[model samples]
Target: MRNVVLGFLGTQLDMGKRRRWRPSISLCQTEGFHVDRFELLYDRKFSRLAHDVRREIERVSPDTEVLLVQMDLDDPWDLQEVYAKLFDFAKDYGFDEDRERYHIHLTTGTHVAQICWFLLSESRHIPAALIQTGPPRGDEEIGTFDLIDLDLGRYDALQQRFDQQTREYGDLLKGGIETRNPAYNALIDRIEQVASISDAPILLMGESGTGKSELAQRIYELKLQRRRVKGRLVQVNCATLRGGGAIATLFGQRRSHTGQPGTERSGLLREADGGVLFLDEIDELGMEEQALLLHALETGRYYPLGSDSEVTSRFQVIAGASRDLATLVAEDRFRLDLLSRLNLWTFRLPALRDRTEDLEANLRFELARAEKILGTRVGFNADAADAWLRFARAPDTPWPGNFRDFGGAILRLCTLAPRGRITRAQVDEEVETLRRRWRMAENDPDARLVGEVTDLTLDPFDVPQLAHVIRICRTAPTISEAGRRLFAASRETRTSRNDADRLRKYLARFDLTWASLHDDT
Candidate 1:
């Protein structure tokens, strides 16, 4: 009897998929049996990719044991995202949840597998050795083979490689962020504090464009570098945590005591054991999860889904939210207890409006960053910078979107700019675009005024609209009567002021006031 190897090929399995899996030469000498059918599952879209892979797997290997090789193209280097997707697929397909039967490989290529494996196993202390015999001296064997149980020194060498690779990636990210960006500096201070001191849960409050994640990453890196924290910094966006398995994902669940049952996958908190768990959009966490989180924070203990055994992991928690948690607590949307626990050291990121002083610096920094990212030299001229400053300082301008908004505006200006330097006109145009979207633009002083301008253009008005309204008001019996008559035409136009102060201001701008008419007499 020949051992039949059933493989369900995913993304990299496609004919065009670039990898070292050259079946023609590699599998040529398999004597007893041949690959019965090679199902090709490939798609550019991710949702379709998973479905296609699953469908083809079922089609090709309906009964025989299948080895799944899943390709997660979303973030090719992100092992966590890839593993989560694979775990979900296994559960959705009712794969036995026990242990040790299925081999699920995530590979971009033969060489990439080792790289991915290195990254994935960096934090874990799994006892294993990978000894690779390079290509034969001659053409006897073209590739490499791995031998298990390497000497202690060799295993340590592999670990050192993992450390080196991890450091290289860190340096790359750090180099990208080393700048005088004021926002970056403020974020650096917060990250430093969070890393150095583990006394309280740090709450980082900022709008969406403020690079909350970057700050978190910096904090994690700095902490690891300074030897303040030992474990990995596990980040989880609460908005993405949804449905029944969310708790299971937060807390590890034991393996089903049957064939090939999936083993317990460590939750982020567990993974971050001695480090910081950065929770982005912490306000969006479900009520139940919030309560569970509160319990953990209070007692410093949590029960993983399948096990009654309480797992104790201590680490600093850094929670980021777009809104103030106090309001959420007031609305009963968030638990006061959790809010209290997380209120240790709260840092609210200044909105772009609040940090207007730093606008010029930020624009220059963002422009350079954008240029680097786009692989082009995009610059701002003196006139363009002046225009942007004027717009940023305009009374009608409200950057509700913050730094992100400015970045987008600059990018648009770059696109509209003739050569490379963005112009004042482009800045104004983008400002108007922002104004319209955010309703921050001052309302055009009434279309009726425009109509009056047109009419005045043809035949000059004997008196301005303000003068006409005052004339109507003067003839009225009382002040109330005057208001009723003057505002009657507004019913059809729906022109009204939400605030009396605004109305007063609008009237003041026209140099017309009740006192002006009274004094005119």
Candidate 2:
């Protein structure tokens, strides 16, 4: 492979007395290094020096070809302009990495230019190693050169700083709460990286009250702080958008059809331009709206309702869904193309039950938030704290509503606490209240698993037992596991202890199957 060196012309150094060696010329004349081509970037004012350096390089290494790249920079010290010029040059340059090994000579350009080159090379925009050339010390005709392969992991200090910054980003996304869940921390870390680098649509999947909406807002704030986005974050709850006016609500209307005055609207998309558009409960969007949204996402332009001209709104999208969009697609309720577009950076936030270890941390966070809102500091006593922790981390806690439920529990505990100190009595009362609420929700046919899966009305006595059975089946890995849990006490009394068979028969009576319940879950 041929070696190609790219650098800027050092006008003052290369134009010095003929005896002194400059970066460009010295790079070409380095011992045991063969430069097949030297692509030298220079301002118009330094054209003469660029040519002189090219001549000297050609004289020292005749086999090397000289390509002068003229960059019109009014001020090389201007970082933005210099970087833009170099970026344009690299983008337009025909790079054949297979046949040519590229090197960026960092010794020739201005400090700003050198910084730009390093950034470009580090980002693989130029796909080259950095080379710094120096003048000869003594008795040597050629200068020395050092090749820097920009492997960031090799730099411990830099890697540590990067890791620290990443942790900070994650913390920012978590509202500065130091959660104890490893999976959750890792998820935040991945989200931090993606949010920093990409403007693609992000799909947040989780059950309701899993903090998807809060996390989406945090992501927008992160981008805003980093200057990745400029406009305000516009959030739309897709479930709330319904009826014939849904399109106009999202895409805006050109004018009032009823001849009413002052009905012009710019829409949420336009308001989100240059920022982030968060669509909470995106799976609830109508089919027509989904199609229009898919079109707007693919092309940053969309026509408003009753308008001939097209309007543009370039924005990053963060979509939150409580339901499985792929399942909706399979059911033909959601647009497959829209799901494809939004699924690029999908992240599923774990439910509160899945992250029980984070219960205490979230409890503290909620308490602090409550203090801010209520204007009074409130916390549980030692016994109450321990009781709350034990109940929260219990396997059967069943945090059906996740963080939303947890936050409500905290708020109520604070409100009921005497003199801002929640005692063991208050904790016991709150726990029982939570249990009663959960039990009621579970027994309510309209909200229970039995209601969701089957349309049949069952005996009042059978509903609660059947609902509990279905809930267990949904969470258990297999029919045998669920049956074992449900029939543990009774199995010893049975002559033939076939738990799975018994469970299957019970489910068959209700026209339900293990596979169907598991899938729905």
Candidate 3:
């Protein structure tokens, strides 16, 4: 079924204002939807305008889905009151079906696009998400903001490009726009090489926030630019693959069992047959499924989940895994043969810490992103930079979480930074808060057997020592196992014993003992 997005452009409030509605108009036209009408709602405030919008909704099409759109002023607008207005209007107009048919999109032009998700009760903010217009902004007559598309698929594509370009510029451009990192350049070079190839299963391995998916898409686009493929890049999260029968869900299930009468819809793999298939977290696939995938990759064939008939499908396979495949294979959790098959062309994306040269560049990239997102300029003060420099090089804590963690901390400080500059104290406070919260959470019974190790001083001297302790804790099955890892083997066993004794004393001093190991206890 084709979904229709209908938006009402001007309000009485915007009538006299230097309004740019042409972009919105052109966008609707280009989107190829049947526009019933575009009436100007002149009321400025929620109380007055909502009633008029409700009337328009009923008049337009009482039975169809109506998405009421509005401009976000960034100023304090009473959201509770705004929703009340929409609710009252929907109730009066009889638009409220069991499942909410009427939707509201609160957009702030080219700035931050605030969303009011249709929850049953109230609307809350979805953090770290923003919306902006596309390039060659002149295409939209209502300024670039008029071109903001609310379609999820289109939005995802646009935002993906924006993030990528922003990062690229952060690395390549002058004036601190791009971040320079050896690892990023290396990964980009690898992506270029993969893009040059047309038929090879590529394995992308990295920690969670290392931009694996982004790199995968870049490879696809590069391939497309090189005239190697013509189909859309179809992506599936293997972590979320399910076993529900009725084959139609994966490929479009035939509407009916009778072949002659059923619709022949395509499965995701078929949809992307000529393009690329990106399977995220492929390590999550069960052994039986892994065998199926291996067969498909080897023979260019995959049967629908419940179908007896086999289908011929060929697509460039790009898979990502945060876990170490060698470790998974050793543990018998993942297939070694399958890994060998996909590892034909492999690229290991390094974590944020491994590329310290790129930290400044990444920070600049993220800061630009924040400015674009927040509709305001934001920068790191000398103090904030020093604080980051302090921990940025920690061998024991070089961001196991990678870019995602970096983005989060940067964003938090960006938001909290007064007058667009993040202070050193704020950085220190945030870091301490993070550590404290982590320690508190570790006290939970469900917490795993891991240590939150950090160096007291940002100097590189203690990093490896701290990391040794972390490695010892992570590999240990029990206190005794940890003891073994810490103490096993050595001609000069005295040093090992001394270190173990010192570590045990340190743990005791911090009230962290073997019993604190949740996975064990």
Candidate 4:
């Protein structure tokens, strides 16, 4: 195969006395080196010098052919111009890897040109290895040459840089919170990879306050930073989109019969074109809305309310659902087709209570955020901090509202701190307040359900647990479905996982049955 070397002419370096050997000349005349052809790029102003160098190359290496190509540059230092010209050259070049070996002469070009050459070669725009030539060491005219292959995997420094960048992106997605949970970190890593590469619909499923909306926004921001999206992110809560105006609110309305003809509305979907549409609580959307959404997702075309014409929108969807969308689909509440389309990249974010280990880190982050919000610094005393951390990490701490509840607690503490310091008394007060709130919540639902179903005085602890189970039973279509949801995490480890059997036994202890719970509900 013929060996081809391509480079820019180093006008000053190649124009010394005839005896002096330069980078381009030395590369061709090096001992034991064979250049079948040399493609030299030069400005039109250096046409005479380019001819002189080509003649010298042919004279020394009689078997080699030198092709002089003109690439006029008004300013060699302009990186944009240099890169664009070189990119165009590479794009137009007919490279046949099977017939010839190509090398990019990196030593002769300007620093900007050298950088552009590196980028082009690294990106495989120019399928070539980079070759650098330097002046001879002792008495040799043929100088020294080093070949550099742009394989990132082979370079530890480059690999580390890429790894660091990936870590930074993950941190950004997490709002700079130094989350230490292994499962959560792994989840973020997967999310980062998907957000960077895929434009498909992503569904984020988690309980309320579990950061679904935050993560969706982060995904949009990441895509924007990576230049994947050019339009703004349009966020809307599907739960609020109800009744007569839901369709118009989402798909927009055409001009009224009595209004101007050209004043047709563009809608949220149109506004989200070339960007992301975050539909929080997506399961709450009506059947008609779901059908329209599915159509838009599949075809990128939808009609405005009262309009005959169909408008187009090219957008990606990031859906957030607190409820089990699969269950909703099973119950015939949500459209199966819409769910299927959104489920391609579904991720379930673990609730705060499920990841208690990360509570301390999240608490500190919330504290920092609160300080910024209140424009005042606040810190817990040594004993107070320990007490709060202990209570926050306790297994029984419901944290039902997740980070939302956690952040609110932090803000309250900061606001009530005396002399910008939270003492044990303040911590005790806050803890009591949280306990009362949780107790009230338990009594409100549990007491009412238990009171209506049967007249039984139950232990305080059992009331909340049994109330939760009964609530799930009331909503789920079958005992098995309710059991599956309640024991989702624990069932994974059991050898013989019969959720229905387990749920039945637990309910039997309370002298209750799924049938009895649903009878009143």
Candidate 5:
């Protein structure tokens, strides 16, 4: 398998244009790095330089192919835009070649570009080794280069100390939720380390259904199994913890004298003493609660409601938020100090849509759970399994709800399956039900309107194209306008035509019209 090299074309003119050009890419080829293909990202203005560099590499090493990628990016000096462009490039380029390994050339780009590459590799955003190339200092050598894996715990001399400790815990975390993504795998290992050694707060930031709560509880379990924490795990959804009772619920309260003789209650903080307290949706905490919580987290002291003396509760905190806490802090809704404390070991869980590669494994895991729950063994027929997996993993299936959606879907199938056996026909029927359900749940007025007018009797195969057409009809101001855009390419030679009537008649196939689609949902 040949290696694919990704790099940037540097603009530094240390070597004059007329001088004997010694490009890093050319040196890389000459040094026999075996870069079967080079994907160089550069600006439009650097076309000539990039072309010359490519030509030089091809001239020096005939087997190496140099391909230039044009980027529509903002200031090259701006790290934000540079990082965004690089990030977008990584997302857009499909790295589907199994035999070809990727290696990032960090020596031939701007400082910002090099930094972005290093960060991306470090975080496993780019699953590649960092290649540092430089001009040879000695007279006897070609350009000097070295390959470094971002995971120092994997290949470094200190592997025995840092890497070996978390190896078992890494496996444990993947017991239920299986993932093959390098970023997520590395994240599990990192989570194991923080959950094992440090008692400092750990924050899991990601969208809902990305398994934040599950991961939080898993962290506690890992700690408990290792005898790191001898107490029970206390979990709370802060979103549901609002109102006057928020303070009493979180910090406990003594018996009330003024009210109807309320009994003393142990709040979540006290219950979480000597253990891990996982707070999901931590951003929902109001400012007053935020202040009190910050004080308790910082000093381990909080006066329970209706108490004069301050009580102490020593507990490890782990917080999860679907929204960005920094933005909340900036908006003065959340405490900056609390944000600072929790930001120490933050990990972002990727959404299910982003981890579609793990669909098969996760789907099987969900089926196993359904079996345990229903106390009956269930299995999907070959055709049924294939059909369901295809729909679930399709690009258009925006898994806004993530894993929870998968669980619900599996439960529906398992509940309806006869003799614990799911057939292709059942899969097809359930798929249509889900499609109509999704259409009904649409929040957008135009999409909802389109869905209302859409004929569900149409063949399932026609839904994709029809759905797009309905959306176009709802958005276009006039029937003629919609038809013109739809027939733009085909009607290029014939500018004047009755495209409106054609489109109107086309919609009649589904018992619809342009006017009906534009109605509010």
Candidate 6:
């Protein structure tokens, strides 16, 4: 396959005719490189010079295809702005179909333009190596050309160093997070990657019981070990921060007027000045509190109530929310600017229900913790473990409370453990408690109907089949209608049969009636 080169048309071509021979063409010929094509990205102001560049290139290498690409970077002097535009262009360009290997010529164009190309190539925005052309000076008057690998990320030693650092960071943060789920592990890896280096406000968003607070503490610990923060970890549930003294409590009170300032009473933020300040359930903060919090974060200094002097916290903020701040922002409840600040390193922890695959491991983890605390180890009996997991992770059970409920169930089972072992009997009671709690919490009509199935005790094994029948019964106008729909697929194979009677018999086995279900719904 042939190699293609992409680069900009240097404005140096604007010089006198005899003084300029396109360096890109000379570099290829001098270095004995046979490029199949050349893609020249140029500004409209350089169209005439670009044409000259193309003609000069083909004059030397007639077989080389020259493609003129017009770019709209009016002024390339602003490196940041030009880099952004070039980066966007590179992303939008289709690099996937490049069957032929390619090189980005870095010799032509202004130094800023060359750096832009280098940045693009370095980040793999373009799937090619970098080509640099040096002017001829010695015996080799044709100068020299060098092809540089753009895979700087894959530099053996550099990547290995990064890998080792990541592993160390992962171990530090992975202390209690024992799980084998890929997505969850990936989330952990990402958290480790960001938490170690970023001093920016970190926002953790998730439903209740997803371990946001736990993760926040872990992050604090990691940073503390690294000496990123020197003070203690100060945690406060934003929901609990209320009453008229909320400001005083969070920011401390200044001494009364008259005499010199009294002893400085440091608030939570000041206490966490050199460490991490964790605000859990931040969505619950009142607008006034939010304003104060935002001001402190934005300025790194907050005023104590009744004090004119601004106290410096220098605290790293880690905010947790159970609600979507974006939605709150749209509703004008949350400050958009504050959200933007915290969103710099935002990570959404997955809900427990979404991570059902890790249920068994996490359950065992809680049990182990219980054993450590109570000094009595307990293992779930095979049947009990199976039964407990089934009931807890069932789709019918709305784990709206997530890991909080799961942990509580573990605690209950440990307390109920007999002979250091959880028996099937204990699991049965715990499962029922969870089911009842979920039933009460849910307001869905279907769940409400299921809760009305008072006479029947549906175990884990019986849930799937029984739940379907219950749904069909609630939705169908009559038992006959329910039966036909319930067995719609199977009934097609039945030459002759009463679906209503079949469904009736099925419901009778479970001690449920169609009339009872429909009326309940």
Best by TM-score: 4
lDDT by residue for model 5 (379-402), tens: 999989999999988988876557
Question: What is the lDDT for 359 in model 6?
Answer: 86
Per-residue error for 434 in candidate 1, Å, reads 1.6
Give residue 211's lDDT in candidate 1 (0 to 100). 58
Q: What RMSD does each model have against the real structure?
A: 22.3, 16.3, 23.0, 14.9, 26.8, 20.9
Report the candidate with higher TM-score, 1 versus 6: 6
Error of 5 at 91 (Å): 56
Provide the overall lDDT of each model, using Cα atoms, as 2-decimal numbers: 0.57, 0.84, 0.57, 0.84, 0.77, 0.76
User: By TM-score, is 2 or 5 better?
Assistant: 2
**Candidate 1 vs candidate 5: which has greater TM-score?**
5
Off by over 4 Å in 4: 1-26, 29-58, 61-129, 132-147, 150-154, 257-264, 443-521
Q: Using alpha carbons, what is the TM-score of model 5?
A: 0.54
For residue 360, what is the lDDT in candidate 1? 69
- For model 1, the superposed segments whose C-alpha errors exceed 4 Å read 1-195, 257-264, 415-417, 440-521
Better of 1 and 5 by lDDT: 5
- Candidate 6 Cα lDDT to native: 0.76
lDDT, candidate 3, equals 0.57
TM-score of decoy 3: 0.49
Tens digit of lDDT per residue, candidate 4, span 1-521?
A: 99999999998888855447677878887776699999999999999999999998888888889999999998999999999999999999999999999999988879999999999987889999999888877886568888887666568888888899999999999999888889999999999999899998999999877998788889999999888899999987675565555677678887872277874667789899999999987876889889988999999999888788898999989998888988998999998888889999999999998887788888889889988999999999999999998988888898766777677777888888999998999889878877766666665877545543443446778777887887677556567878999999999999979999999999888768776664321
After superposition, the stretches of candidate 2 with alpha carbons farther than 4 Å from their true spots are: 1-9, 13-154, 445-521
Report the lDDT tens digits of candidate 3 across residue range 1-521: 23333233334322323343332233233333333333222224553555544554455445433344453333434566444544454344433235332222233221111223233213312111122322224454433333233457986898999777655533331233344565666566556655565478888888776878777777777677667878889776664444432134334444344455545567676787888988877876667768777887888776764457788877888889888888999999899889999888878888787888777767778888888878899877886787776777666554645776677677777887898888888888878755654454356322211223221222333334544555455434334555656656642556445544555775664445543322110
Give residue 116's lDDT in candidate 5 (0 to 100): 92
Per-residue lDDT of candidate 2, residues 1-521 (tens digit): 99998988887777755456676777777778899998888889878888887888789899999999888789989999998888888898889988999999888778998899999987889999989877787898777779888776567778898889787888899998889899999899889889998888899999977998789999999898778899999888776566656787789887754356676778889999999999987887889889899999999999988788999999999999999999999999998899889999999999999998888889889999999989999988999999999999999998887887888788878877899999999889878877865676675753455555553446767877888887677545457878999999999999998999999999999888876564331
Model 6 agreement with the true structure over 283-389: per-residue lDDT tens digits: 87888988898889988898887688888878898999989999999999998888888898888888787888888778878988888878998898899999988
Kindly report which residue stretches of model 3 are placed more than 4 angstroms away from their true locations once superposed.
Answer: 1-184, 243-252, 255-265, 306-308, 437-521
User: Candidates 3 and 4: which is better by lDDT?
Assistant: 4
